[model samples]
Target chain A: MTGTEPTADETPTTRSIPAVAVVDAQTPGNVGTIARAMKNFGFEELLLVDPPELDPDGEAYGFAGHAREDVLPNAQEISFDELVSSYHTIGCTAVTNEGDHNHVRFPFSTPRDLAQRLPTVDADTAIVFGREGVGLTNDELARIDEICSIPASADYPVLNLGQAATITLYELREMTLSPAGTQLPDLERVRASQPLLERLYDQWDELLVEINHPEEKREKTARMIRRVFGRADPTTREVNTFLGVLRRATERPDQEE
Target chain B: MTGTEPTADETPTTRSIPAVAVVDAQTPGNVGTIARAMKNFGFEELLLVDPPELDPDGEAYGFAGHAREDVLPNAQEISFDELVSSYHTIGCTAVTNEGDHNHVRFPFSTPRDLAQRLPTVDADTAIVFGREGVGLTNDELARIDEICSIPASADYPVLNLGQAATITLYELREMTLSPAGTQLPDLERVRASQPLLERLYDQWDELLVEINHPEEKREKTARMIRRVFGRADPTTREVNTFLGVLRRATERPDQEE
Candidate 1:
């Protein structure tokens, strides 16, 4: 029964990411968890349909992480009919039909597919989730414009509500949030340059000769070393360390003799 | 302290999916949630390091869904050193370093990348997750051979332990499970043949003739109908329905006049 009126300035038309709608959620904690996931993935809007009482001191608040202040408090409440008419609705269903015989669930897009497709769509979209025990009713799913399913094991395709929402948001993060919003370190590493690699390989060859390595096997061994380093994609620091180790080994033969 | 000896016949060598290891999980419910996600994605083995007491009547059992009888109960207890020594470990972390200076957290693979890379690796691998609140310590991350990170919004990059495990498992399902294991319907729907589409287009032209549709507009309207049906990829049933409706519309104009 808890609802709030969206401010005139912050309407659905102004937002780019899809609003998340939970219909008849039995547990307040799940609502909070979904809201938290929304914040985690840069989704701003939340809509609830027949949600449980979300008291300030309840489990919902406890599980909301950082979303309690914004995403949870500003959640708008709307009727199912109003949701269908106002936005392009995509129903989230864990259990999908196996064939086109039941078109309500078949021909569904996975979250990855939706991530790619939703960008070209011009309408403001809402991704709807159903109750915890039984997902969206067939009638409700039929009314939605499209269906989205997460690919899972046939034996147990059903994921708990929170997990489903979090995973879906994670897949859609690229479109919903800018690349600058990721905390993951930049993937571009400064691998050792070709000259440095060649010097290292020469040192390795010299060490093999110093150790009385067979002349016939020297070429093969050198090729193997190149392949190994190529696959490892060693950084400059790693290559320098290897060079140092090889220098010590190559010099040791003279010292020992 | 609870541990079981893995039977001789069913060892790590025979299994294809990575063993999911939870290092010092504080909550029994989180442990159960991880186990349930493992089952959902066809991962079999569960390894625990200093886990909480998983009593039969505890929250662990309640939240395990179908994993209680198998994955949770059979979880093996091992020390962190034992984990590093026995398996090729890939540590899972939420917060990663921003540059190559911190090698422990940098140069990590996303779950999608791991899904492609792990299959080629010949060794048995274990994907390790750390504590809920503090995640894996830097020392622990350094010990693991590789790292896998789930991309998230920088504002709130951290995900609850259960959500991280669930999403990782979902991404790795392709390598872990068989194609026949999916419940999603076969995507190869029998689209209406070319002849059927031509007939439907011809019927639309006849309807335009019956209505005395403006000659200039008629060609454009016919092309639009063809384009719409082409994009729709309508099945034979749907195309027949369209033909039937168009035929009725064309016949009605003659009857009315």
Candidate 2:
């Protein structure tokens, strides 16, 4: 199983804590800052879905400082669908009072709590955050396994988006502390590389073009691929899964034999 | 003993992660990002060396959305000197390759490996990152134990400062995963809420106005308060610390008797 998937723990320690996934997070500054954020709490493995190689220099580094490279280097930019299919994502956003569950510790509790619960989960979890201002859509939130809320002062309850992500991570780490001596899976190797993901995606695109799907159908096909893999958050273990899917879809079932 | 110290497991679950101390990280956005960085990885204590209160809302939080608050809310802003005394602080920067022992980790290295061999270390090892632009001056780096490097591709060896911080944290987290069940300390009763922080800062200015401290010193004094408590990263245990400090500093020792 890849780092994204939550395998039943051989021992509590053996369980992989869910990771922090930044989906469609477009800001370079935020990217650097988030890297620094991940590092601060020992949460490595930054997955950047659907972003360009960022400008190495900007005002954003003021916070990332020494961490710029760490965050930058580990960051993997992929398609939105890749993010959706690749991860068992737990997306966080500010909820209004109408939400019934004000206090479920899963997402809002603490980093430590989240970590503890990870082993219990059946699939992988990647925490997705939306771009600033336009928080995750209902569609996006619906895709998540569970929704979490941080209890904030009722008045200005919404946390700055990145801050919310950071808080969830913070709480997750706090919750993760326990059952030591559990062998952590090696530092997860992210998707092969941008070039690799780009090539693979391109290969699929070529096939899609050939299928001669209707103009309106093209977008739907792309979106479908995006959704299935977005939740997958692929790791070395899943190379075969994609290879198989790509082989079948591209070659056509008739050609597989 | 305080924040960023690598205290031997009082909590059975917390693996020893390297501590990162900000030696005068002046940018408000940087501060917030750093705090968020820590939270993302499940770290609580962020030690700031002498920073301003209500550090102007730089892009740090706006980008962070909810996370920007961590720089203010969860940060333990302290003096560089106090942090050094409190933990194993490596006071250096990778400003230029010649100046720093920059062992760039472009490929990757665990932050814990660096943590184990940290310079002039205490159990609580702190890697002190400096203020903007001019990193820790040679004078500051000298006090450090040993310089650690985030191995980078030889080409772009120097990471943007904040990115450097992000990378460092990422590496460290790779090494140390706290044993599960390590709980975070609860928030101090009198957290410097946005309003609280804003009001206190302004009131302190007025008080300084009353005392007629130098106009220049007014900002400096306000900054000092922010630095000290912010570094403290106060929890429920810290309410009295704020009140007590305020009582003594504002009212005058002479008046207390």
Model 1, residue A233: distance off in Å is 0.5
C-alpha DockQ for predicted model 2 = 0.02
Docking class of 1: acceptable
lDDT string for model 2 (A1-257, tens) is: 45555567643335555666666665666666566556544565777765534766664464455556676576776666777778776666655223222222222333334555665665556777766666666766666655555544332345455566555554454333432311221231244444555555666676788777677788778777756555434443244446667767777878655
Instruction: Give TM-score values for chain A, per-prediction.
Output: 0.87, 0.54
Model 1's DockQ score: 0.48
Model 2 chain A: weakest 10-residue lDDT segment is A179-188
* Count of backbone collisions in candidate 1: 0
On a 0 to 1 TM-score scale, where does candidate 2 land against the true structure?
0.37
Model 1, span A85-168: residue lDDT tens: 998999999877665565677667889888987875556789999999788999999999888988788888888888889888
